[model samples]
Target: MLTPQQPLGSGFGAATTTDEVMTGIDLSGKTAIVTGGYSGLGRETARVLRAAGARVIVPARDLSRAREALAGMDVEIAPMDLLDPTSIDAFAASFLESTPALHILVNSAAIMAVPELTRDARGYEYQFATNHLGHFQLTTRLLPTLRNANGARVVSVSSIGHRYSPVFLDDPHFEHRQYIPLAGYGQSKTANILFAVALDQREKAHGVRAFSLHPGAIADTGLGKYIPLEHRVAAGVIDEQGKPVRDPARQLKTIGQGAATQVWCATSQQLNSLGGVYCENVDVAPVMKEQPEKIDMADAMRLTGVVPYAIDPASADDLWELSERLLNW
Candidate 1:
């Protein structure tokens, strides 16, 4: 049976940090792959997991940069670009051949609202390609190792931004509809939740559970590098100088606070039997009572519950098929 999309009241809240979630959790001998593990919440996630004794591998698009950012950390760094299919395949192939098991997979890498319209080599929108399709390809390829583990979990870092748009099944590449940065980003994030839902349904019997979450609006991370300063300032995420700022109207998260939900989703004993639900601030997010007829960026930035469109089982199943077909899997 599917887990309900409601909070378990795990006694954790928005203020919880990544380190706080790791209290008493021992991950010795576990192996984890955290994409984008060199920066932002990804870096913090890798750090805490390593502190708990898990062997973490960080796949980077730039090995030198990853090495520099990850200096002094005992973790493996490999090359893989989410935009490049050949690289993703090679990385997956190598890991499958050498690694005995993959206890955790955190699809934490993503590109947020790019100001301009961009597409991948296949003419797919850049955001959708990187955030959803790429992870889709990577996770499907890693199924064997995940299943081999005693209890494997795949954590996807979705966002409240998911409420900004539904999947544009008809024209995701902006072939017809106008290209709006937030819209593309929203569709991709929505896809992330649907992907997790469909994946958990398929893999739960094999001891693998999948989850998607909003890591909170962290202001200082490189994830917001592409967002224009004015927009961010208006969004209450930063000051004029790019420093993190807190707005009473909209809660702002520190890096540690932002990384908490994914870590909890990946390691919490409370969710051992739970999967396929979207989470926020360390708890399963409630399903929204009604989806807005139009996209509302300001409303989305503050709200918590996930829209029903994101977790619809039919849509999830259909998306899974579409993704597999797109990737030729």
Candidate 2:
């Protein structure tokens, strides 16, 4: 049975840091792959997991930059571009040749709200292609290694931005409809959650559970680079001085706090039997049945629940099939 989309009273809250959630947990012999591990929340997560004794591999599109950013950290860096399918396949093949098992897979890398419509080589919308489809391809290719662990966790880092829109099954690539950056981002994020639901349902029996989560609005992550400064200030993510506002209660968080939930989802013993749940604030978020009305950033921050469409089982299955068809896998 699926875990209910509701909090389990996990003592941790929005302000919890990665170190706080990982206090007693040990990943000594575990192997983890954290995409986008060189920066932002992903970098913090990689640092903590490595400190916990896990062998963390950070796949980067830019090897030199990744090495520099990860300087002093005992983590491996490999090349893989999410926008390129060939690179993904090569990266997976290379990892499988050396690693016998993968205990944790955190799909934490993503581009948010690109200012204009962009597409991948496959001619698919860039945000959807890189964020959802690319990870979809990578994860599916790594299934054997994940299952070889006997027990593993795949954490998909989604966002509250999913509330902007569900997957557009009819025209996910914006081929027929007008392109809207947030909506495109929203569809990809929604796909991330639904992918977790579908993947967990299929892999839980094999001891490979999946999860998705919102890491809060972290301004420093560089995920919002495309959004204009004025818009960001309006969204309350940053102040006039261009500094991140720290308000855990409003879901605005520091790097450590923002990295907490995905790290928790990846390593917390509290989630041993739980999977396919959309989480926030370091716990399973309640499901909101209806799409919320248009609200400002402050109001949106106060709303932390996952929408039903994003976690619906049927929609998950549908997305799985659609993704498979699109990837031709």
Candidate 3:
């Protein structure tokens, strides 16, 4: 049976930090891949995993910058660009040649709220291409290595912004309708969840399970760099000067706290028997009523659970097929 999207009361809450989640859990001898691991929540994830003795591989778009960011982290940096299929394939090929097993895969790289519409190398929507399709192709390409592990886990970092829009499969690249950055971002994040659900269905019997989660609204991260400061201030998420608003209702988390959910999803032993669920705050998130009209800070926090459209089995299956056709894999 498919796991229901409901909290299991895992005793962890919104305040949990990455280090707190790693307590008493050892990842020694495991191998992990964290995309975008040079910055933001991804960097912290790589750090905690490495501290637990896991060999982490980070795929970077800028080799020099990644090397500088991860100077003493003991991670392997490989060149990759989510927008470039050839680059992705080359990186995957190189990793497969040397890696025997991949115990964890964290699809944490994403772009959010770019003011203007952008397309990738293949003429696909930039948000969808990088946030969803790129990870989809990478996970599939690395399937063999994942299956080699005893019980592999794939954690796709989705977001609360997923509520902004469902996958516009008909015009995903904004060929007909206008491209709105927030809507584009939401569609991509929703795709992340659906991808996880469908992937878990296909690979669970092979000892691989997939999960997706909202890491919470975190401050001091590169993910929000593209969002205009004025808009954030208008939303009450940040001050006029660009600092985070100190509001309990805003549900803002520290970078370490924000990384908790993804790390927990990637390495927590409690999730061994469960797969294909959307999680938040370190537990299986409950399915919430669709609240498309609510986009403010408080509503964003209140609507923390997965929406119906996101976890729909039919939608998940359809997205998988669409992805396969798009990538021709």
Cα lDDT computed for each candidate against the true fold: 0.91, 0.94, 0.90
lDDT of 1 by residue, 1-329 (tens): 99999999999988888989999999999999999999999999999999999999999999999999999999999999998999999999999999979999999999999889998898888999999999999998999999999799999999988888889787878899988888889999999999999999999999999999998888878777777788877766777787887542254788898899999999999999889999998899899988777755456567779999999999999999888878877
TM-score of 2: 0.98
- Each model's TM-score? 0.97, 0.98, 0.97
Write down the RMSD of all candidates, one decimal each. Answer: 1.4, 0.9, 1.4
Against the true structure, candidate 3 has what lDDT?
Answer: 0.90
Model 3 earns a TM-score of 0.97
Better of 1 and 3 by lDDT: 1
lDDT string for model 2 (1-329, tens) is 98998999999999999999999888999999999999999999999999999999999999999999999999999999999989999999999999999999999999999888998878999999999999999999999999999989999999999988899998999999999898999999999999999999999998999999999999999999998899889888899999999999999999999999999999999999889999999998998866667755566788879988899999999999999999886
Candidate 3 residue 68 C-alpha distance from true site, Å = 0.9
User: How many clashes (backbone atoms < 3 Å, residues ≥3 apart in a chain or on different chains) does model 1 have?
Assistant: 0
Report residue 173 deviation for candidate 2 (angstroms).
0.3
Encode model 3's per-residue lDDT on 205-296: one tens digit a residue: 99999999998887578788887777667666777777875433345778888899999999998899899999998899998875666585
Candidate 3: pairs in clash: none
Worst 10 residues of 3 by lDDT: 244-253
What is the alpha-carbon lDDT of model 2 when measured against the actual structure?
Answer: 0.94
- In terms of TM-score, the best-performing candidate is 2
